[model samples]
Target: MYSKKVKLRFVFVIVFLILIVLTTFTVLKVLKDNVVYFKSPSEINLLSEISNKKIRVGGMVKKDSVMMNNNKINFIITDFKNELYVTFSGTVPNLFEEEKGVVAEGFLNDKKFLVADKILAKHDENYMPPEVKKSLGE
Candidate 1:
């Protein structure tokens, strides 16, 4: 037979251990993997530090820089300081065009071209999405 004090202590220990496990799981699942990536060209120039990190790279599609051959489109995105070549084969957004804001999600290949897994077109200020605007720090 256990004393009242021992039963209370056992219950407290079980609850305390459960709380610790739950807190650790929540922090690892939500806080750790929910990182949002933001970058401009000059910032990306420092990519050697975050090169392996999946990130969001934003810049303007250079005017007359977009070239298309079949389903593939190649263009230069510039942040006014640096430029990166981007290649996307999927259907582009309606706003995707030369001299427009674009965010490409992917990794930089050995060829220096961004192999975009996703392409997002940034609209004008009056039409900007709240998330994109916030990402641009606007």
Candidate 2:
């Protein structure tokens, strides 16, 4: 047996709690869709199943693994234990080179290869873009 005012307050609190829970759930669901996991070539190669979801793969570009055909660029990322091939059509970063650190964002294909949408190159201090080097003639 609850009084009228007490029942109204209880109902208000329940509604507020439900709204908070719904809002929290919605935010987490949205964040989950945007989350991308970063993995190395060795880790990817060991997966039981290949996924087509977008992901970030980071490793050193293998020596003598870079090749260009027409406008497309193909390279192999290696963790020294395993290799993951990557295909990118757009212009690559200036520091992208064999034996250098690179991260590619893209989808995995049937051959466990990455079809890169973007390529990011990591370099040390004293690094220069090819365009800059060309303009400076060095």
Candidate 3:
């Protein structure tokens, strides 16, 4: 039979281990909170309650909708059903053009424009990499 001291020590060790695990889990959860997720303009409605959070907006660059002013370029991204205005201040990607797919990363501004820090042009399905082409049976 274990002595009272040994029983007490065993309980203390188990409690200490559980506390350590909980503390580690809490710390990791806090860190993960800073990471943001991407969404389309149509998906924005699903996250209406979570405004002012950083996110990536992916959609087609609206045709004849890009307007330039000094260093800022304002454009509209559309997902066929919904659209969002976007403003970015940087050199556009090589593939960036009207009626092309684009993914902008930033947060929505007070004026409802997506202030993008970067823009990524999406490739066309007709000219995909070999792996993607094979996956789609193209």
Candidate 4:
């Protein structure tokens, strides 16, 4: 025989917990929908099925595998075990070049080809801007 006050408090606490759980689930669902997973060329080569969803593939640009014609650029990304051909029609980052690390965001046309919408160049941990390098004298 709990008092009326105790029942009211229990109900309020239950409602608050439900709201919290709902909010958390909503946030997680949104995040999951927007997440783009990164995979290497070797990993992609092992996929059993290619999805239409967008993903990011990162690896070193194969040497002399880059070719450009007007706005479109084609290159090969390699992880030393496998390679994925990428075609992008846009301005590329300055750091993008042969033998550099790159992450291309786009949909995979197949296990060996990717149609990239964006290109992101990655630098090593020791990389420093020219100005800073000049100042540091090494």
> Whole-model Cα lDDT per candidate?
0.80, 0.87, 0.84, 0.94
Clash pairs (backbone) in predicted model 2: none
- The sequence of per-residue lDDT tens digits that candidate 3 reaches over residues 2-82 is 999999999999999999999988988897634534567877755646577677888899999999999999999998888
Q: For residues 4-69, could you state the per-residue lDDT of candidate 1 as single tens digits?
A: 999999999999999999999888779653554446767667655546555667889999899999
TM-score of each: 0.61, 0.61, 0.61, 0.67
- lDDT per residue (tens digit) for residues 73-134 in model 2: 99999889888999999899888999999999999884458999999997766668889989
Best by TM-score: 4
* lDDT of candidate 3 at residue 132, scale 0 to 100: 92
Runs with alpha carbons beyond 4 Å of true place in candidate 1: 1-37, 110-112, 127-138
* RMSD of each candidate relative to the true structure: 8.0, 8.0, 6.5, 5.5
* Stretches of candidate 4 exceeding 4 Å from the true structure: 1-37, 128-138
lDDT of 1 at 16: 100
Candidate order (lDDT) = 4, 2, 3, 1
